[model samples]
Target: MAVTKRRTRRSKEEARALILEAAETLLRKGGPAAVTMRAVAGNLGITDAAVSHHFGTRQELLEALLHQGGRRLKDELNAALKEWRETKPSIQSLVDVIADVYADGAYSELALQLHLSGWRDRGSGLLNSVVDELHAMRTKAFAAGGRKRPSIQETRFAVGMMHQTLALDPLFGEDFRRSAGISSADKPSIKQRKEMWGAMLRAILEG
Candidate 1:
């Protein structure tokens, strides 16, 4: 006699996580166009209506993705902060750590998609809150390293520029740079670009 196999039931939280994970994978594989509710539902062997029950609209799903991305980013940023505290913060280390955070193609592509997909109308508040939190962390990190913390306004400017570069790189980074006739020597890698950006941010913070 064979034993019956039981289907594992997921709690609402677990199901929601599953849905978002599926969406993230799809987004990574084919960008935003492939991350519909139906697609996510199919990925989890559920119905589209079930996904809708968890996320009322496509915009809601996208908001959830943004939140998920934000949490992951926070974790990594926190680690970077810890590392900065342990070691003397150098421009190259800062550049390397920041480059690691933003280097995930899926994360950066989804970020750009969220911005372009009318996040302003849908869930800009959520994204803005995340940005604020990250900036606050940056301030704390600077203070930890005995560096002067930048004003909130200056901090916002520095972070905004960094975010913009990360978001656009996937869409038109290397190709655009090459098309503009910038040689490899002139056009630096993401890590190198962040070195310059880090220097600018450090200057603002120190001033």
Candidate 2:
């Protein structure tokens, strides 16, 4: 009984740590495809069987990790929005928060994966649900105090721009800079990025 209890306790702790690390790595790198039992094993210096024993299946491991990441971002954004609201911040601040949600990181990476999967497997039925959730969030914001709403096409294009910002910006910058004989080592600042986001939001609003 003592041996079993000790093993159980260690297993839970190891699993918890493994999954948490896996989630952070996945967020920083790519999403589900970048995460694997072997990778976690390699990362934590554990056995594949140990990871498998804890996660059971790759799908389950992925779902759990994704869930954890989602919870973290949700908590972060919720706290930020609540604090901002208390200060009576303006509409642009709220728009920046919304834009930041779909900007980058694990959610954005996995979202692209899910979108591609949905295309390959039409019956998977994820794209529409995600679209609905985004729409609902937007509507809630509008009800809160948004001054305008873009048409469906405009909204779709605007969100597509935001969602792919990180991926596209570097590529766009590199090509343009290279053509101008400029090294791409010089990166834009956060202020520049925020200004770009604000400009995009403004364009959508004015559209």
- Candidate 2: give the clashing pairs: none
Q: Which ten residues in a row have the lowest lDDT in candidate 2?
A: 119-128
Candidate 1 residue lDDT tens string, 1-207: 999999898899998999999999898788777889999998999899999999999878987887787777667666666676687545455445546655656767666677787674343432343346556766787888898764777656666666566556756777888998987688886656777767775665555
User: Which prediction has the highest lDDT against the true structure?
Assistant: 1
lDDT by residue (tens digit), candidate 2, 69-186: 5565456556655675577534355445544554554565554565565522233221233334445556666667764653555555655555456434432544765677856566
Record all residue pairs in model 1 with backbone atoms less than 3 Å apart, i.e. clashing.
none
Query: For model 2, what is the alpha-carbon lDDT of residue 67?
Result: 58
Cα lDDT for residue 63, candidate 1:
76
Clashes of each: 0, 0
In model 1, the runs with Cα more than 4 Å from the true position are 1-4, 121-152, 175-180, 183-187, 203-207
